[model samples]
Target: MRIRIVGTGRAVPAERLTTRALEAKLSLAEGALEAVTGVVERYVCSAESQIDLACAAAALALADAGVEPGAVDLIIGGCGVPYQPLPATAPLGMQRLGMADGAAAAFD
Candidate 1:
């Protein structure tokens, strides 16, 4: 079987942080991280739960793919940050997306 990446989505925090802005927080020279990483700005997740971000990203991805959330057979989320200690991030995301219990799986 050939699996398809029907949807792709990304989420960034409401707050925008730039390399120059971080300089004050880290006491580093301006563009110091940017010089090495080539990243001028990065999104940081807010106090909001990771599941919220995942759900938002998933919704966008599904919309881009022209698929309905209930039609999704599976959902795989790979994130460096996780929302909680007990339950995996994916289940929470699935719940947020209103997917059936067995319709999808999430990984983080």
Candidate 2:
């Protein structure tokens, strides 16, 4: 079977931490981290857990696909490592996405 990607989404935290701030926090010289990493800034999650971000992104993806969550037949969570071990994150993600029943969930 061929897999077709219908839509994509991303959820970033409200907090924006710049390289300068990170460098200070790491006690590195100004511009040192960015010079090597090429990362100017990063989103830092404060209130939202990783699951919250995933669910928000999933909502956006579903909306972008012009389909309700019930339309999804399967949920495949990638990135290997769960944010924390215990009560697999995919099922939680499926529930958060409104996949109350019928959808199969898995992780890679």
lDDT of 2 by residue, 2-102 (tens): 77779788898899999999999999999999999999999888988778988888899988999888777677766445776655677778877767744
* TM-score attained by model 2: 0.85
Candidate 2 residue runs with Cα over 4 Å from true position? none
What RMSD, rounded to one decimal, does every model reach?
2.1, 1.9
CA displacement after TM-score superposition, residue 43 of candidate 2 (Å): 1.3
In order, candidate lDDTs are: 0.78, 0.80
Candidate 1: segments with Cα more than 4 A from true spot: none
**Best lDDT goes to which candidate?**
2
**Residue pairs clashing, model 2:** none
Q: What's the distance in Å from true for residue 71, model 1?
A: 1.3
Query: In model 2, what is the error at residue 17, expressed in angstroms?
Result: 0.8
